[model samples]
Target: MELYNWMVEPFQTGFQIRALLGGLLAAVMSSFVGVWLVLRGMSFFGDAFVHGVVPGIAAAVLFEFSPFLGAALAALVMVSLLELIHRTTSLKEDSAIGLLFVGMMALGVVLISRSDSFQGSLTAILFGDALGVSWADVQMQLLFVIGVGLMSLMLYRPLMSLSFSPDKSQALGMRPQLTHWLLLLMIAAAVIGSFQAVGTLLVLGLLIGPAAAAALITRTVPRMILTSLILGMISVTVGLIFSYHLGTAAGASMALVAILGFFLILTIRETVAAIVRRKRSTTLVEQGAS
Candidate 1:
């Protein structure tokens, strides 16, 4: 009876409800925008954006504000900074990204390391402690997810046009740059929402691997997105299960599982392609010899 009670304890905890909901939201949001990130060659941008919020998070902690607000402010600042760099500096996007990310990350580290309340929670914020999730956290996650979904739905035509070709999208009267900005903003929101549950470091895998894996398996953007959502959900669910059994952070475990899914896609695709090529090559050789 004691063992049964102990085994069921984690599930009964209020934190578990928060964690489940939060993880689900992160998975959904990450999967939604991830397809665009992969298509735009901006996978790293997701990582950069997430890491870029560290300083703001630290500041929020320092001032006793909600981490979400701080992270959002940091994201907006980074977006504006990138725009400024593009317009004013000769440094390209990659150079600007590198400079800004490192600088912000360093500042965040300093602030977090100095703040007592945020010290231990740093790990919770970074790698995620699903077991530590609160009602507020879960609610915040749901709002972001809903907001992003609405934006995507409302601007589907413009976003689709913008993604494939900026010039064409513009020709069609869609403001590609505006949509681009909006998309990045949504990505930032997703990152902030995810940061507390999954952390900055591991969120990249959630945003990248699932989408990339889906790409390998599917040809159309919608199909890719569907696959990504399914895969991301799988990762989260399996990760939660693993975390429960292994006593590890669900976020880290989920990220790892998603990465493994990426590799799994690659292996299957490569093996199938190799076999088809071999068969074709052998048939051609036999015909030639005959």
Candidate 2:
């Protein structure tokens, strides 16, 4: 009975329910797009992409426009600049990413600082207000989930081929370049859709944590994606429960849970593997003695 009440207590209010729904939607979309980011070794790109949209979101907040549009435009600008630098300069992609990451993040701070409610707006954008999620936010996130999920499914083969071999993907007429752009768009969408729920900085936890954890436990992409979704949902639920009982910030709690889950699974996996190796070595020594 105590356990049941502990689980049910968080959802006793309307705002809490909305928060859960928004988080779940964010998780779904992040998992769908995050797997590709991990597979392509674009974790750095993912980090930069999230930060890249901050200026747009900050501008939207200051100018009284839709954040989604601002984020989308910012995403486009970031990608375009990245590509331009890559094509026009001798610097590596990482350099471009680093440049934009710092530039955009700094610009966002500058823009937000100009706001009348500077501290409040900055805090909300960076850390999020999970319990303050609205039904409209949930609705928008649902659309993102559906769009990202379907696009991920559609681009699976192309993305897989590209991850393993861009040359082969291109030779196979898979259009690796187009697929790469689409993946970027998906990542941007995931980040934009989720930032309101988890905040821009913390959203990276959901975007990479579950997928990275799943990669350790699952072999195939499909299995990894499935595992990531399950783990992501579990993190959200556990985080919300902890937030309710401990009076912690819900979004931070959820993001922290996702990140901690990855380390916990990694530790357990390594421990078990070590134990297995020790047992195998013992067996080999016994056989030699016999």
Best by lDDT, which number? 2
Query: Mind giving the per-residue lDDT tens digits that candidate 2 earns over 1-290?
Result: 99999999999989999999988888888899888888899999999998999999999999999999999999999999999999999999899999999999999999999999999998888888788899999999989999999999999899999988999999999999999999998998898899888999888889899999999999899999999999999888899899999999888998999999999999999999999999999999999999
Give the distance in Å from residue 200's predicted Cα in candidate 2 to where it truly belongs: 0.7
lDDT of 1 by residue, 43-159 (tens): 767778988998888888788898888988999898889889999989889988988889888888888887776668577667867667788888888899999778767677788
Model 1 clash pairs?
126-199
Q: How does candidate 1 score on lDDT?
A: 0.83
lDDT of each: 0.83, 0.92
Model 2 alpha-carbon drift over 4 Å, by segment: none
